[model samples]
Target: MLYRTLGGTGIEVSAYCLGTMMFGSVGNPDHAESVRVIHAALDAGINFVDTADMYSAGESETIVGKALKGRRDDVVLATKVHFPMGEGPNRGGNSRRWIVKEVEESLRRLGTDWIDLYQVHRPDHTTDIEETLSALTDLVRAGKVRAFGCSTFPAEEIVESHVVAERRGLGRFRTEQPPYSILARGIERAVLPTCRRYGMGVLTWSPLASGFLTGKYRKGGAIDLTSGR
Candidate 1:
């Protein structure tokens, strides 16, 4: 498979990163089967793996961890934060406190010393961008994470983050993982352009619209997702 250097970071990731949103209890509950998919993806030359801590309340990362037990070094692993990990008021978000703590949780679950790319899963209206950058910068400096990025941020937020990171001596967001699908083309006019302006890499999520395009979600039927909250 083809590989490309992620933005300015020297880490080379596969052209096709295996997304693990559906590998856990929220989507698929079969841990053994999920492990098979992950191994097969690695065997097929997909060296990049993207997941999130909130996925199935962290079960997805566990499966990924088990799958990469022996071959972890061959993958460019990425995961996200910002969603609530528990009922605690401060259990999640883009705040420095949460980022600093949640990253360790992510590291522990993935069974890796460093993450290839750690991303802010979504914009946190309550938290300052500088706070997030400051925390992530600490991770990079400590070698706990190679780089950090953001996902689903507005075009303006992306620009502001770059400015703030530069001004405050924090690590800049080297990538953007926005949700881009045929049903969602709004990013093309703005988000993509903003990322390009800052030389940030683009790793889109839900290019298939969470299986909406696969005829899996039947018209007029109830939604597939049932919130635990």
Candidate 2:
């Protein structure tokens, strides 16, 4: 598998990252089978594994932790935050409180001393971009997170984040995780360019348009809403 540096962080990662959103009860509930899938991806040279704290209500992280038992150091482990983990007001968002607390939970679930890349799952309009950046900066300094980035943020927000980081003298976002596929090319217009200008690495999602381009679901074919991504 081909490898590339993640943003300007100097850490190389495989071109294909294993996304574990469907590995838990929300999709595949079998722990042993999920572990096997993760192993298969690693064996295939996929050194980047991406999971989220909120995926499968944290069960996905648990399974990933199990899968990476002896192979953690060889992989560029990534996970996300900024989603509600429980039914509460302070359980989520991009605020410092949530990010600082949530990182510990993610580390525990992933069974890792430090995360290669810790990303915010989505933009939280309610929280100031500086607040989020400051918190992430602390994580990097604390040696809990190697780098931090945002996911699914628009071009404007990405720029705003960089500006805030520069003004505040904090760590800037090193990467971006956006949705990009043949069917969804919106990022190409501005988001991609913005990331390029900022020298940020990019990891795209839904490359198959959530399986639409897989040919398994045709234009006129009926799709089962209950299954598939």
Candidate 3:
């Protein structure tokens, strides 16, 4: 796998980051099998791993944590927050209260003292971007997270967040994770160029278009739900 520096941060990561969204009950449901797959990817030279606290309600992080027991230093670990973790309304969003607690939980589950990249899973329309940046800045200063970023944000929101970070003197998000594939080209219109202009590293997801590129989903044949029916 080719490695590239994420934006100007100087941290090199594999071009194909091993995504662990499928490691937990949401996908594999088997802890041992998930660990084996993670190890296999690591053995194949995949030095980046991306996961989220909300994946399988946090089971994915637990699985990835165990997988990285002796090898956390070798891989660039990235994870996201700002997703609903429970029934309470406060359990979600990018507010300072949630961001502080969520990141700690994420670190606990990953069994690491610091995350290479800590990201807001998505933009919260309700919370002020300044609030989110402020909380993230604290995390970076405290060494809980090396860098901060976001995922699935609209171009305008991305720009706005940068502006807010600058105005408030907070550490800015250095990367953007947008869903990209041959079929979904919407981000190409603005998000990609915007991130490029801001010097933000862009890590795309669903490169296979949620299994559309695998040629498994036919018009009339039997369908497999496990592979995205």
TM-score of each: 0.94, 0.97, 0.96
Candidate 1 local distance difference test against the native: 0.91
Q: Candidate 1 lDDT, tens digit per residue, 76-129?
A: 999999999989899988998899888889889999899989999999999888
Clashing residue pairs found in predicted model 2: none
TM-score, prediction 1: 0.94
Model 3 scores what on Cα lDDT?
A: 0.92
Candidate 1 segments whose C-alpha is farther than 4 A from its true place: 217-229
TM-score head-to-head 1 vs 2, winner: 2
Residue 91, model 3, lDDT:
97
**Residue range with the least summed lDDT across 10 consecutive positions in model 1:** 220-229
Q: Which 10 consecutive residues of model 3 have the lowest summed lDDT?
A: 220-229
Q: Model 3, range 1-229, lDDT digits (tens) per residue?
A: 7999997789999988999888887788989999999999999999999999999999999999999999999999999998899999799899999999999899999999999999999889898898899999999999999999999999999999889888888989899999998999999999999998899999988988888788967888887666651
Candidate 2, 80-186: lDDT as tens digits: 99989999999999999999999999999999899999999999999989899999999999999999988999999999999999998999999999999988999
Clash pairs, candidate 3, are none
